[model samples]
Target: MEGGLRRMSHHPRKRVEKAVGALNLAHLQGAFYLLFLGCGMAFILMVWESFMDVF
Candidate 1:
């Protein structure tokens, strides 16, 4: 019974670690997506401005 309890405690700790890692990955992905979107928008705006100048 004591060994079982110890084993159960370790599983929860592992689960907590996995959850934290998943959250960090999600945060990194969000930041990357935002950066990508910002860059794309900036590129589009530059192109539009150049076109306007030509016209």
Candidate 2:
């Protein structure tokens, strides 16, 4: 009975680790996406400003 309890505990610990790893990956991906979006918007604004200056 004691050995069975130990085996059951190990499975849940592994599942927790897997869940934490997946969450970390999702956070990193979201951060990178925001960074790229900000950079693209800045580039577009610069182009627009330069065109306006010429006119």
Candidate 3:
């Protein structure tokens, strides 16, 4: 994960290398999507916990 992030150098245009373009595009999006879902669930859990504590 760290290696992949280092490869990007935070540049949009250079994010994908031609040889592994398909692999990178597919998996990177999946990784980001799963990360998004994970964060969403964590936030929901926190909100629910606080709401339950109120009662």
Against the true structure, what is each candidate's TM-score? Answer: 0.89, 0.83, 0.63
What's the residue-level lDDT of 25 in candidate 1? 100
Q: lDDT per residue, candidate 2, 1-55, as tens digits?
A: 9999999999999999999999999999999999999999999999999999999
lDDT of 3 by residue, 15-46 (tens): 55554797888899999999999999999999
Q: What lDDT does each candidate get?
A: 0.99, 0.99, 0.87
Per-prediction RMSD in angstroms?
1.0, 1.3, 13.3
Q: For candidate 2, which ten residues in a row score worst on lDDT? A: 4-13
lDDT of 2 at 53: 100
For every model in order, what is the number of clashing pairs?
0, 0, 0
Which consecutive 10 residues in model 3 have the weakest lDDT in total? Answer: 10-19
Among all windows of 10 consecutive residues in model 1, the one with the lowest summed lDDT is: 5-14
lDDT by residue for model 1 over 1-55, one digit each (tens)? 9999999989989999999999999999999999999999999999999999999
